[model samples]
Each structure stands twice: as structure tokens, then as C-alpha cells.
Target: MTPAETRTAGTTPAYAKGRQRREEIVTAAASVYADAGYHGASLRAIAKRVGISHATLIYYFPDREALLAAVLERRDEEDDARGFPREPVGIGGVRHLLALAAHNARHPGIVELYVRLAAEAITPEHPAHDYFTRHYRDARDYMHSAFSAMAEGGHLREGVDPRTAAVSFIALMDGLQVQWLTNPDAVDLVSPLRFFLQQVLTTSLDQALSRQS
Candidate 1:
């Protein structure tokens, strides 16, 4: 019998037991997928990990694509939940972003998943296309708003345009993570980010105040 069948064989109440089985399936699939990459992972392996029948896994996920999409969506929501600030970043904002960058850099699996899934999502017909598109847009919008507020508050130098600044800030973090993921020894990700932010703020604030002078 399939792994799915074996799992359901216990004969508990449908609603409660079904929910527990689904969570187990997702947990098993997530670990296998993260270790093996989406294409390398198989339904059989996920079933084996869950100690259920392949049919049981299928009953929950239906197919590999559905399982992969669930993983990506779950990760996106996790990222979003932590990405925005609860309070103003102010003098400490750059450090917070740098810390996040460092954390992502240390976790190569997460980075690899994001890079691979993002490329897949570009095909228009891909299941995650809409989700990835919206994720990027919303992240950019939040960043733009954050920087624009900081600039207007006179925390930034005058000549620095807030929108451009925000874009550059995100771009730098994205680019750095890619590099650091491959060469942690070559990149001082946090220090450099802090330095850059300090310089931008000083130059922009001086220029902003100079306009009044």
C-alpha cells in the first residue's frame, strides 16, 4: 500500500486526523525538498520520510508541483512577516537590514530555494508566478515608503532622492546576499552596509540642510 494509505489506516475521526496528517506531509516534504532541491525530491521520498504510503502523500499534495508551490508560499509569508519594522528604523535601521542579510547568507538552502523558485515563477504559466510578482512589488513599496519617511524627517542628506535611495538600498542587500552565499570569506556584509548607510545619510542630510542655508 502507498505511504498515504498506511497513514490513514489508523481510523481516527476524519477532520482532526486529516489535519494532522496534512501537517506531517508538509513537514516531511519541506525537509526533503530543502535538502534535495525541488526536482531532486520525489513523492516516494516524501512518503518514506513521513512513513506513509505514496498514495497518502498524493491525497494531501496531489502532485509534486502542488507541494513545491505550498513550500514557496509558506516561505514567502514567513519572510513578509519578519521583513517590515515594528518601529522606526532610524539610526539602527541599516543595522537591522544588515543583520537580516547576514542571517539569509548563512542559510544557503533558503537562498537557493528563493533563487530557483523565483526563476521558475517567471514563466507566466508557473503556479507561483503571481505570488512572486506580488511579493517583490510589496517589498519594494514598503522599502520606498520607509526611506521616503526617513529622508523627509531630515535623517538623510538633501540631494538623495528617497525612491532611488530605497531601490539602491534593496539592490545592494540582494546583490550582497548572492555574493556572500558563495563566498562568506570575501564579503563583510554587515560592516559595509552600515558604512554605506552612514555615508549616504551624512551626505544627503548635509545637502538637504544646505539648501536652506
Candidate 2:
């Protein structure tokens, strides 16, 4: 059986309790890391937030890096559960991203964590560097496929390159997040993204219609 299946099959009461405790620790750690950032967040602080001692916290995650990794993994899992693109395919994928931005508007903490960690993870030695690297690679690939599908459907403009468009779209989303985080009152997130999508897709559709006319 697969490792996942094996784990499922072998789960006992003890295993279940351990998983529960681990999830509690991760949830608490996420908040601490979000508030303090990875560099500023301490194991003792997280432990305090979780109402556990440092030694108990260490029992679940042997090191700070391991705890950070678990927090990131948990975030990804939660995002996926919230419909954050298991795969990229069509206009729905673009819509999903916009929806995510709207959802993020309500959760400044999560947004702060993502923006801060993503910027910090640019360093090669950072614990989350590899995570961010794989994240961007996968996100770009999915978006590229989505754009390619749009092109295939005759919804893309004649001169638009799917690969370039995909990259630009991701960059725009990240840039907007940074701007919005910096000044929420001054910068609107979802509106600009919606405007961009309308401009890009509607222009493409118009071009396609013009060709047929």
C-alpha cells in the first residue's frame, strides 16, 4: 500500500491524539510566525502561545526550521482546502485567484505571513527558500497551462504569449499583495485584479471577435 494508505490503516488512538496535538501546535505557531516573522518568532514564544513548555514544543518539532516548515505545509494545506487551485486549466483558474485575493482581504494575518515569508525566502539559505521556489515554479506552470488553454479556446489575443502572460499575471498578483499590505486604505486589491482581468480577457475576446468579423 502507499505510505498514506499505510498511515491511515495504522492510525490508532495514540496516533490520532498525536496528530491532533501536532495540528494544535501548527495552528498556534502559524499565528506566532505571522505576527513576529520567521526571524523574530521564537520557540518559547510559540510554546507560550500554545500553553505548552519549550520542551514539549520541541517534542513535536525538533527545531525551529522544522516547525517553520510544518507551519508552511499547514498553510498550503489550508489554502488548498479553501479552493486555491489544485490545478490550473481555464478562466475558472483566474477567477479562483481573484476569489483568493478577496478571501485574503479578510485575513490580514495570513497575507502578512505569506508576503513576509515569501520576501525573506529569497535568500538561498532560508528555511523556506526551497518551499517558495517550488511554489512559484508550480504556480507558474499551472497558470501557463491555464493561459494556453484559453488560447486554444480562441479567447487569447493574437499577439499574447501564454508563458509571458502567465509570468506577468503571477507577478502582478504578488506586487498587488505587497502594495495592499503596505497601504490598504490607499491600495485596493480585488478591484485592480478584476480590472486587469477584464482588460486582458475582454481585449483578447474583442480581438478574436474582430478577426471573425
Candidate 3:
């Protein structure tokens, strides 16, 4: 049986401890993977980096793909923790989302990992394909709900499609991160994000208010 299977089957304190250790190993492995691409990184190197036996490392992440998936999961947790504000974000909430993005932008490694995984996740058998699919759907749903609320509350511009706007907004942000990976020096990410939010808010509010006029 696989280590993940074994770990799931047992519920003893030792098993719990093993799970925690595995999480730690995955986190350490993430750091290494972020620095070194998947092909460049090896289990032996990850074990050494985590100061654990090679067998122990393998016990948690049987292969590079598993380790990569763990890293992506960690990233998703972090993003959720930052609070992407529920549907129909107010102006302040939009600012908050931008702030979170700007803060996350500092970790170029995470951005690079995301970019790498985007290409790698195309295969049906890829471990991260499901994770990415779920992530995208969840994120889009959240954005759609928020924008719909805003539109209903007269925060959105007249005739503006909430879903389309949400998609475009997120697309722009994701695209910026991709660009930043190649030329971080060329973009002031925080300021640009803030500007985009302001523009969206202004146009939305004007349209909403104009309709009432």
C-alpha cells in the first residue's frame, strides 16, 4: 500500500505524528521545489533539505508529483486564509482583495510554481489537475457571487455583466502574475492592482448611479 493510504488507515497518535511530520516534509519540499523546478529537484535532495531520511521523505511524498500537489494545496490554504471576501465585495473589500494579491506577489516563487503547474496540469493523469480545476471553480464562484451581490446592491454599473467582469478581473490579475514572473522589475504590482480595482469600482458605481438618475 502507498504511504498516503497507510497514513489514512491508521489513526493512532503515532499516525497523527507521522501526518504532521509529513506536512512538515511537504512544506520543506515546497521551498525546494519553488527554488528548483520539478525535474531539477530529487527526493534525495529534498530529504537532505528537510534533514530527514530519504525513506521518511518517500513515506510522505512517494514521488515528485505528490510533493508538487502538496505545495499547491498549501498555497490554496494560504489564499483562503487571506480572506477573499464573500460575494459582491464592497469597495473596501475589493481593496482588501487587491491588498492580498499584492502581498502574495512578494513570493515570486509561489507565482512561478503556479505558472509551472498550469502547464503541467493539462494531463488528465496529473495529480494536480483536479486540484486546479476545483480551485478555479471555487474562486470563480466566489467572484461571481460577490459581483452579483454588488450589482444587486447598486454597486455595479448599469448593464454590466457581473460574471464577465469577475472573469476579466481575475484574468488580469493572473496575467499580471505571469508577467511578473518573467519581468518583476517591469511592473509595480500593488499599484497596478489598486488602480485596476479603483477603475472597476468607479465605472461600476457610475453606471449604477446613472441608472437611478
Best by TM-score: 2
Candidate order (TM-score): 2, 3, 1
Using lDDT as the measure, the top candidate is 2
lDDT by residue (tens digit), candidate 3, 188-211 = 666666555456553643343334
lDDT of each: 0.67, 0.79, 0.68
Q: Please estimate how well model 1 matches the true structure, expressed as its whole-model Cα lDDT.
A: 0.67
Better of 1 and 3 by TM-score: 3
Model 2: CA > 4 A from native: 1-15, 203-213
TM-score of structure candidate 1: 0.71
Candidate 2, 18-65: lDDT as tens digits: 788888888888888778789988889988987889999888787899
Worst 10 residues of 1 by lDDT: 204-213
Per-residue lDDT of 47 in model 1: 94
